[model samples]
Target: MSWQMADIWENIAQAIPDKPAIVDGDKRYSWAEYEDRAARVAQVYTDHGLKPGAKLAIYSYNSAEYMEAQFGAFKARICPVNVNYRYLEAELTHVINNSDSEALVYQAQFAPRVAAIREQLEHVKLFLEIADGSGEHLDGAVDYETALQAASPMPVIERSDDDLYMLYTGGTTGMPKGVMYDHKTFSSALFTKGFEMREMTLPEGAAGFGPLTQALHAADAATRSIPACPIMHGTGMWIGAMIPHALGGCVVLFDNSHFDPAALWKLTQDEKVTDLTIVGDVFAKPMLAALDDAQAAGKPFDLSSLQMMGSSGVMWSAEVKKGLLEHIEMVIIDSMGSTEGSMGASVTTRETTESDKTASFDMAETTRILTEDGKPVAPGSGDIGLICNGGMVPLGYYKDEKKSAETFRTFDGVRYSIPGDYATVEADGSVTLLGRGSICINSGGEKIFPEEVEEVLKTHDSVYDCLVVGVPDDRFGEKITAVLSVSKGTQFDEGALNDHVRANLAAYKTPRAFITVKDVPRAANGKAGYKDAKEIALNALNLEVA
Candidate 1:
């Protein structure tokens, strides 16, 4: 069955044109208003000679226009590639060239970067600027609103489920690779298993679905979802932003850009947010700290409206989950997913037991893990190996067919999407994710996951954030090393930090050396850039290599 994303807006606008569809600070947009604006944007794209199936890149922070531009592109049947606004010239150029994007819809704040790369983007025919209050202007770019004003609100062109949307995965091994998804695969993989099944699914008519058919009847009943992470990231863009909107529910955009705990509290309390989605403890830690401060000050915000709080992108601590639950009266869920396989591979819901919480990974939902020998291991064995899957995996990397064919393969009659994450399946079928297999440290015949060490280090009082990596060691083959961001007004104590890890984890898992700085290096999605961290860690270890 072919499904067009434009149907989502059409259904919402027809049913509840006046109802609020988006809330960003004082700016509120009803379904009709948003549709009208989106249509105009589509027209604008058409006028700019951007035809259907053409690629358009959106580079901006979270805003109402971001959604408008995305839906507008869907209306035109043109693929919209959401670029990370934080990308530098080198990173941005790779995406622009890889996608062969013809137009770029960006915020005026990034005019300088645009100017720098304008000459290099040969395929880019138009630069449409979404003017922020910055009062910045580009020499050859047209105003976003002005361009839209000339175009008529043409009817949305119907697109088949086979139509493609490209999402680029964070490249720890090298440059980022574009992961393409058709509508059917994206919906079945990302929106179906974890999200649609968990919560109360909305009525069929509430969304674009007709009277409950067999396929629709089987979907989960939940209508609401929240994506607290940036829309540029996969979880944030796909699960958090698109899935919720496609369901015709409200998308609560946290526009603070910079995460301020108090601001999050205020937004939650004021907006009566139902589902709070986060990207690990980096986002949650500060909110928890704010909640603590609020309670101490006797001005605690009421977060009773929240039903479910979820963490993805990185592993969140059990301690942090407990702290967040104190403020929110709902289920605390931890999910493990990657851009390669869309969003959710496995999830631990509020119903998950305390014993389950102790385990580093959750069980697979629609996917499975296998060892190097291609044998599936029983759960709880601590026998870690490659993670493979069978589901709505992408066709392959765009343009790089060789790499794509290697990564996207079929084993034992099942097509698996293996992104090379190392994990152990528990006895009860729960999956314990060690870390990315490509970055796993093998020292003295022992496997060490950087994420495990990093999680423990983050809980340290003086450590703000940390990244663990394996550096070359003649004695152990590869020695574990940690690069950390110290908290404000704090000094690094290598011995104290090492002792802390030693108490919590095995000696082999603990970092052999520590380097402290003001901030830990990370990618746009908040995932640790181990390759970059390794470079810094190796330099630091070289001075003290013993």
Candidate 2:
């Protein structure tokens, strides 16, 4: 079916005006209220001189206001750029200015940071702050709710299906790049993936949106998804909010800034949520701990309502998935993809999990593994190639044509998005993802993917979390080092870790040293960040890293 999220959501608002759209803490907003508030946000953007094709960046946590502001940009036919909330001054300025953001909506807590760089970001013309009860406000900034109350709801104008939808890179390796998608391309993928998750197909014609939503609601198939990760990120927004909203489902947001597995479980129980979105093991470990603690306390949560749990962006171990399955008896989805384009995912239920392996995923229809010379890799030939995606790919990075051309290209007359993720083709038409090539380690002139070693470390009981990095070594040229985190007073044996790594992978891939840190570096969205880990490893060797 040909439809845009803006038009479909607007129609849903008219058809089911009283349906719950967003729930943050004790606050609830229905479809009518959601549309009205988003329209007011659009009015605020208009009043600040933002027009179609202008960019509006959202730098905030998972809150009702965040999604409302995003939807407002969608309605205005403007690009909504996501800003990482954990960004410092320079990073903040780079993102806002790089995206050509004319308007910014941020949380009150980040006002000082924004103020520090306000002069540096010449593109920003308006600043709107969402209150966090800190009373911290940016100078000359508009209060979010106050502006909504004062301005009239903007009239629903005809928005182009070609309006851009941007998702900035996580910036773990370098400065973030904005990946742009026209609403038509993105919305089509959204519907296709949404229906695929439900084992359904999109009905034909322009009038299908309302009926599909109503049917799902009538069948109690409408999801109540709680995104435990940051809403500013892709997984949380796409799988957490957008897809659920498309099915006329309600999205629940936790009030706290930090992740509390116990609280997330409590909220899931209280909301009777059907889906929970999270980043891989960084989120799953603590959540599993919380579940165990509750069971020990004889006050286990009522997770019976939970039907599916999805994780992306980082490594999700098979052990964690089995642990969660034992408790909730729900489907666990491990997605292997990036913001640029999705390749595929692995969904595990209780019966199918015995063979559950880490990082092995079924391929999407348009996904392929191609060698450097633009030839498809033969299945089970033990040849490694870059994983490329074709259908519904991005337009390119916002303004960087060089990087865009390198990533999005036509190989053998078919356009594909090759984002530097190396994998091997399996005999069963699957791809065994070997981490990103940019960060792969070259030790003794042998290429090694960190994900393999990291997953091996995670299998150890004493290791809570870890990041593997390469440090300069005199003999091997580069030493594989592992930075790890564990519970206080719990220690790991280096010999045992080495043995474990050797058992799973070759001796060359085993980490030479292990450094303990209170916490491993990860992005706000829980994706592994190696910049800090490399520095920490180099510091252990008295070698400078910068």
Candidate number achieving the greatest TM-score relative to the actual structure: 2
Off by over 4 Å in 2: 204-206, 487-490
Highest lDDT: give the candidate number.
2
Over 4 Å off, model 1 = 194-226, 342-353, 356-359, 459-463, 486-493, 542-546
Candidate 1 scores a C-alpha RMSD against the true structure in Å of: 3.6
| Per-residue C-alpha lDDT of model 1 across residues 386-446, encoded as one tens digit per residue | 7786687888888889888877778788887878877777687766667777787889889
Q: Show pairs that collide, candidate 1.
A: 200-221, 200-222, 201-221, 201-222, 202-221, 379-425, 379-426, 379-427, 380-426, 380-427
TM-score of 1: 0.91
| Model 2 lDDT tens row, 1-546 | 436567778877877788888999878999899999999999999988999999998998899999999988888888899998888887888899999999999999899898899889978889999998878999899999999999999998876777788999864467889998988888888678767977888755235777887888888777899988988888899988888888888999875478889999999999999999999998998999899999999999999999999987688999989888888889888888889888889999999879998888998889989998889999999899999998879999888999999999998899999889999988987888888998899999999999888998998888899999998887988889999997545677899888998998988999999998889998878888888889888888798653
The candidate 2 region of ten consecutive residues with least summed lDDT is 202-211
Give lDDT for model 2: 0.87
Per-candidate TM-score against the hidden true structure: 0.91, 0.98
